[model samples]
Target: MEGNLAAVLADRADTYGWRDRPLFHSGAATYSHGEVHDAGARAAGVLRSVGVRPGHRVLIALPDSIAFVAALLGTLRLGAVAVLTGPELSGREHAYVLGDADPRAVVCGPGLVPRFTSVPVLTGDDLADEPASLPDPVPVPAGAAAYVQYTSGTTGDPKGAVHRHTDPAAYHEAMALGALGMVPGDVSFSLSKACYPYGLGATVFFPMFCGGASVLWPDAPTVRGAVEQARRHRPTLLFTVPTWYARLVSGPEPRAVREAFASLRAAASAGEPLLPSLGDRIEEVLGCPVLDGLGSTEVGHTFVSNTVTRRRRGALGVVLDPYEIAVRGEGGVGYEGRPGEDRAAAAAANAAGLGAGGQAAARIGERGALYVRGPSVMIEYLGKPGRTADALGPDGWLRTGDLVHVDEDGFVHHHGRILDQVTVSGERVLPLEVERILGQHPGVVEVAVIADADADGAGEEAGGGALAAFVVADEVAPPVPVLAEELIGLARERLPEHKVPRSVTFMAELPRTSTGKVRRSALGRAELSRNGDGSLR
Candidate 1:
């Protein structure tokens, strides 16, 4: 387990013997597990020849392809750390990562070599030219650094989460094998790219670990691209984000799209919360169960997920085995009682639908900051000890910064990020709650809720700040002004006054990170003109 990640596949090869089963496919190109293993060995030899020693960091900036997989596995086989990054990074962003990581060498396509000005570049062709043979895999401790995965820099500069050599095994066991139940011959495809942790697990490690094949889409996964790939590859498990599913269901010819998903045994959604309505629509249209889960770069992969057997619509599902989840109240005190133990009793008591107060009371001790501890957690944030200390506590629990409530049955429900919460008239408002309500409207395609500072710089009640919503509407929907008014009316009927969005702005789409998460901080700078009649210009 400590030597090399490629060794996992090698071991499988030794046990079952190598076959020509497709291990990686992008369009027409396909590589068997044996081919990938041999390529990884050759790539490792090339990296070694370039002076990349054990423990040295090698930046991998290639797009999702067999080369990317070879580079990653090759680096791991050499006992070197692979610094995975998106190929679309700007020069400035590349500079920041290069400066922070200080890698010994970089493995990327020739097109991206110019971005790594001073760093030693080992192009894909360079690895291809090397001999396809190498010495035995280098041995390293289980705790040795494996890779540095950067966070989606939505709020600020991305921080690299350093993981250990044993993490991939832990992630495979807990998520891929345990939660996803992937088996040999089950083809998988992910809308998320291989650079991100979620996608890395789904499209890279999970398949390799389970002896299954993975379909890689080199281009961005638009609705059409995703459907076409699904139909072409016939993947049994499809991993994508909520936005893609929303688009697929709302796209014209949903019936045709549903037929494309006929090969899918199950579909998984992550990176953002899946609105219950959207989940229902997906199941109704595609005839596939949508398993929603939550994970972060810091955790390597998902530690909490809804299994195919025991699915939950809004809940993030139960925590995976071998991981501990705790809810911390005000002052960071851990809750003593089990979550959701009294959920049934509370739900029975509030069966009359009294109001928000009744529901609030039912959720009273259940809400708090979420914290997790497990073997799969990252070692630290690279070059940021203070930030690392603030996130990973002394006792080893990582403060998730997410406000959540656990029901009596142990289902974890995410409220919103702690930093994203805003106060309106002295009452705290969670954006996810409002977004969930607005997402139910047929006209609303996608929505992001944020607090806008009032003109007077006082609270909303004092005319200082108010809750604003940026909404993306359906294609055939009415004019923005009419839809805005209808949404407001719907919110008024479903939500409390404090929770209702004071203003609604229509947008072509919400700005999102590469992984499909809304950039809340960017919403403040969005050029949304307000009409005199309170309609979006």
Candidate 2:
């Protein structure tokens, strides 16, 4: 089939008689499937009027709303490649994207119309009032470039991962249909936005594929606002990151919160590993299972997940059937640590019982870098060949850059990013491990551990290099010094001496990218850096 995403969705709505069903529920407004379909057709007319043609990139920087959905589908129907970015990003960030994508046109929110004078600009207002004029369906190969979803940019500059027309349905099949049998009765409420693949899979694709409604709020939601929306919409599927889930269960698990989540059958967390302690609290409050999944922007959506039927606590679940997951290393060992340091990581895996891809038991408990080969994997990064070559090989295997240990039961345990390993003393300490330990502290709302360097013997404690903790706590009884001490003590009790953070700094909030991933590189810089006396650097 010469497939188009807009046509496929419209077909589903028509075939299933879902035209009357709500597809999007925005603030005080509900848009039906048929209405959204007509809106997409009208949006296509708007884009075509502005001279956007097939294969041309149309950068979309709209908030989460039906307009965003319609514009995306309209771009697809016109055979244009959609480029997504967050509307809330800074002006500098938007300029960077404009330089990178060099899009033929821009579809932005009202607040951002002033920033795109270089390109033909369109907004939701343009699409809303346009007469319903359905254009002829563009006939393009299924493998044609459909959209570009940018990386989270937590480490550095973001790269646009180009996805094909066939990828979204593949995501729906692999996760929504395969992991959790989604139904028309389900309603999706996702905290992640449309600019992210996690949000797209949960809110736009998953629910739409199964004829369910997606709750779309234009703003980044607070805990109170999210709960109120859930109460109003009564969503059955909750999709968000681990940090948001942690916030949802903090303090008193209020009656309103529980009631809001009472209709939910399951909540899935990605972006980072869900701490088991936080998961327990989330499930307890919501009275539903919280499944942890892992995926990347390049792979479209989750290729590995824990479903309600088969969940392994604290581990990224078994690989989905649509993808092949392999852990690669030197001599069946993980390649992230210094020299033979990862030998201990292999040993710990062996102790817990390990095996890889039905290989020999002697190679058991191997720790290594993960590689995923999937149908939805991006063909390339938009325009950067060098960056694309570094991450993806000609053989179609994507170098995931994540380290993991696979158990006999096929559960994948995340060991943080390979680049995040901190050399504390002679031992290698993954900051995520220390961060996980520190997160258990009652006073610690959020914590990010990073390797910090100082002029004076690494601040006189960690010998050459030290691990620093950046924390966020809103309502703590103790002073900053006392709470820092308490968190350090807790880490010491839970982790090895070398693994524990050497110093602590309190922050109002950790610097995060658009996707909510902590900026470890920015953690100990500028005003975030600290002195021996606990003052900013």
Candidate 3:
């Protein structure tokens, strides 16, 4: 409706009297749309009072609370780029990000105050205690950088993806309204903290744009906390990763507990492929179908997703119509990972001519790396043009690094990462494919299948053996022997012999990155500390 994102969103809400409606439901406190924008406007005034200016970056490292949202909205309102980071990020990480972004000011907790002695570090209280009145939103082009969200560092060191003032609105229209069919009556909750890119779209963009309310908590939720929030907030929709879903229904399926989420029509899962068995558990116990999708920081939000209305049982669902996809196979264009060569190959893939609407399909069921180009994708990676070139092409295509196969029904099936492929017993095995089958075992709460990183891809099998599975079993799980048999036996029933794990390790928990993806590379070191019986020493 208007130009700047904050201005436009504020205009829409005010025009509809939505400003008086509840926008954030946090514990017993509710912040109305007008209250949040008022706080945001005051926050902008405070940032401006402290000498912050348009086009400058404001690093915001806070929890999933009203203050974080206020800081983000205020920064955008002032025509500045906001750099988002997890509040729990280590001092070293914070230092690295501060150096990389070189922000004009910071909005963080008190603990970070010592390190930012030279720069202004505004706490939540500062934003809440600003002057009574403030100026209108600063004018900026829709394409101007509005924010920077760093990657989870799974692929490499974190790189900031710069999104535009128009992007969040685009995401809201394409994903929230178009894909999820969210309405003003909907209320949402997410396991991802707002600092995360996926969580940003879920809790911030979706709810705000749709005139729906988001349930906010200061910290990341535990399994109990997740259920509690669901029970209390009664959100109509939920967004999270597969890990939380498995944990929620683990140990036992609580039918009464499922009532906590009875209001939810569906829960969306991204960040990883959702295991079919876990998905079933979610459906049965949570009383909602777990919708699976795939996305990255560069893509801004889930570009390929499954909605409650249109979804398959075990697929990533169809690509959203606003975006176009191409699979890079043997003969297509792709990025070469070099400085200048980063223009094309890694994303567009090794395929022939482009199909209708920028698509280059893989064979009906063959594996190929995915490439996506859309209006919602990032304009560039902030301050990392070389790495950006490697990941994004001149054509606007982003190299997803995700290997997927399109089914005859047009659903996309995840086949692990293009770089994550490993050979076991002379056969190439997709860990995710096998992990999904093994994950179906009742005793398994979580699982990660990996081959030895040291193994030669050409001839020698990984670990000089077949595959291995690192499992976090339920508390009531059987001994390693029985659990191993059940998991391996389950995989054997659905997968080839080579794909079955030759060794099984019982772990209290899988090592994970802050954003919750399994740290697959860290598992490689577990082999070094193993005892004679093959368990971790």
Give each model a TM-score: 0.92, 0.91, 0.91
lDDT of 2 by residue, 1-537 (tens): 238888988898999999999888888999999998888898988888888899899999998988898889989999999999999889999998988999999999888999999999988888766753668669888589999988988767999999998998877877898777789989989999977899988888877788888899888879989998998999998999878886777645556689888999999889887777677778888899999988899999998889878898889887776787667775443322211134556555555444353333334346678888878999899899999999998878899888787666667788888888767775677777887787777666677788776523453244556677887763633787788788889988998777777778887667777787887877757556576645355
**How does model 2 fare in lDDT?**
0.81
Least accurate stretch of 10 residues (summed lDDT) in model 3?
334-343
Best candidate per TM-score, number? Answer: 1
Stretches of model 1 off by over 4 angstroms after superposition: 331-365, 454-463, 531-537
Query: Which model is ahead, 1 or 3, in terms of TM-score?
Result: 1
| Candidate numbers, best TM-score first, in rank order | 1, 3, 2
Clashing pairs in 2: 334-367, 354-365
* Runs of candidate 2 exceeding 4 Å displacement: 131-133, 332-362, 455-463, 474-479, 529-537
lDDT of 3 by residue, 1-537 (tens): 337888888888988879989999999999998888888888988888887889999999888888899899899999999999988888888888899899999998877777666578898778877664685898997578999998878777888899998877766765687568898889989888888878899898887888889999886678778778888888998888888877777745477568788998878888888888788878988777778988788878887777767889788887775776666676452212211232244334424444434455344456677888877799888888898899898888898999886655556778888777777766667788878787777777788988854334433433345677888887777877777777777888888777877778777678887777888888878354654444566
- Give the TM-score comparing model 2 with the true structure, all chains together: 0.91
Query: How does each model score on lDDT?
Result: 0.81, 0.81, 0.79
Tens digits of per-residue lDDT for model 1, 4-107: 66676677765775446778888988888888888888899889887889989999998888788889888988999999998887888889899999999998
What lDDT score goes with residue 22 in model 1?
A: 78
How far residue 47's Cα lies from its native spot in candidate 2, in Å, is: 0.9
- Global Cα lDDT for candidate 3: 0.79
